[model samples]
Target: MNFEKIVQERYATKTFDGKSIPQSEVEKLLEIIRYASSSFNIQPWIIKIIPDKETKDKLSPASFDQPQIKSCSHLLVFCANKNVSENIDKLEKLMIANGSDPEKAREYTNMMRDFEKGMTDEKKLAWAQRQTYIALGNAINGAKSLGFDSCPMEGFDSDAYAKILNLSSNIVPTVLCPIGYGTDKPKPKLRFPKEEVFM
Candidate 1:
């Protein structure tokens, strides 16, 4: 589908049929997310895929008893990786493996490390969270492109999710994307006038 059509056709799915998206399609959607851009190419995020109904049942209460939690085929918990330095090191290695000069890779990674060191702990979490949203954007749009539905949700309890998922201190759950075949149809697209939205 064209980009315009994808954007217009996609909606925040409110409810989903209890059907699983094919594994191949799910992998394609993940590729789209993996390519999402981030500052410094640090890629400071980890996604936990929950396809088990039992876990979904456990998490729904934390999400205000939202129906989407249990009805969706899969839930993607996008977590911001607080360990920015580790990602920087991994990126440097990837660069060298992909034919970048070793010295240049080191130089780029050093720059990223310096930038990360300058941020406070709070700043690190905030920055990572912001980057994670970019991935979430890709996820919703990509779902539509691949003939499925998705809901980008922030209504859940983050702390509760972290505890339920047993995430480390460095992994902070930032957003949720529940993907499935929607039982509900999309309403008409509503938006402000183009003139008002664009400067």
Candidate 2:
């Protein structure tokens, strides 16, 4: 499908059919999300994919008992990684490995490190969380492009998710995305006109 159609047709699926999406399709969707743009290309995000019913059941309550949490094929916990310096280091190595000039790679990564040092812990989390939304956008649209359905959610309790997922202190849960086949039909698409939305 074209991009226009994908955006127009995709909806926040309230319920799913409880059928499993093929692992290959899931991997392709992950690739789309992985390539989401981020500030400085630091890519400060870690996605935890939950495919088991047992874990989804545990997460449902934290998600305010949302049916999407349990009925979707896979629950994606998009976490903001606060370890900016660590990712910069890894990116530097990857660049050099991919035939980038070693000096240029070091220069670029050092610049990113300097930028990272300017942020406080709270700022780091906030910035990283914003970046996760970009990935979340790709996830929702990408699911539709892949012939599936998705719901991007922010209603879950982040602290509860961090504890339940056994995530590290540096990994902060920022959003939830559930992917599956929608059992519910779409309501009318509502939006303000471009005149009201854009200057």
Candidate 3:
């Protein structure tokens, strides 16, 4: 399907058919994130593709009693890794793989290192979280391209969720997107016009 069509048809579907999606389809969504753009090209996202009953139970309280947390085929706990820019080796390897010349690769690596130095704890985590959301948007749109539906959600207890997911304070949870086939058509779009919201 065309990208524009996918964007137009995509919505946060609330109800999902109680059926499982193929593992390959789920991986395809993650594959989109594996190449998602980030500041400094630092891939800071880690996703826990939750399908276990006990883990799902642990997320119940964190997700504010949302049924999709337990009902959907897959509950994706998207995390942003805090320390994603510590590796000079990996960054240089990627630069060379992308066909950068020796001098250009070294120059880009230096710029990334400098950027990392100026980033504070708060700034780093905030930047990481923003990248995770961008990946979430891509995953959702990619799911739509595959004829699946998703609900992007942040209405959850972050601290509690971190504990449930066995994640440290550095790697924070930002969004929960449940993917499955939709059971009901969503209500009509009711947003103000682009001119009103954009200006």
Model 2 misses residue 133 by how many Å?
Answer: 0.7
Model 2 / residue 150 / CA error / Å: 0.6
Model 2 C-alpha lDDT versus the unseen true structure: 0.96
Window of ten residues with lowest summed lDDT in model 2: 107-116
Give all TM-scores, in the order shown.
0.98, 0.98, 0.91
In model 1, the number of clashes is 0
- Residue 4 lDDT, candidate 3, scale 0-100: 94
State each candidate's clash count: 0, 0, 0
Clashing pairs in 1: none
Q: Write the per-residue lDDT of candidate 2 for residues 71-154, one digit (tens) a residue.
A: 999999999999899999999999999999999999999999888999999999999999999999999999999999999999
Q: Please, what are the lDDT tens digits per residue for candidate 1 over residues 73-160?
A: 9999999999999899899999999999999999989999899999999999999999999999999999999999999999999999
lDDT of 3 by residue, 77-143 (tens): 8888887665455878877988889788888888887887798988888888998988898888988
Local distance difference test values of all predictions, in order: 0.96, 0.96, 0.83
Candidate 3's clash total is 0
* Residue-level lDDT for 102 in candidate 2: 100
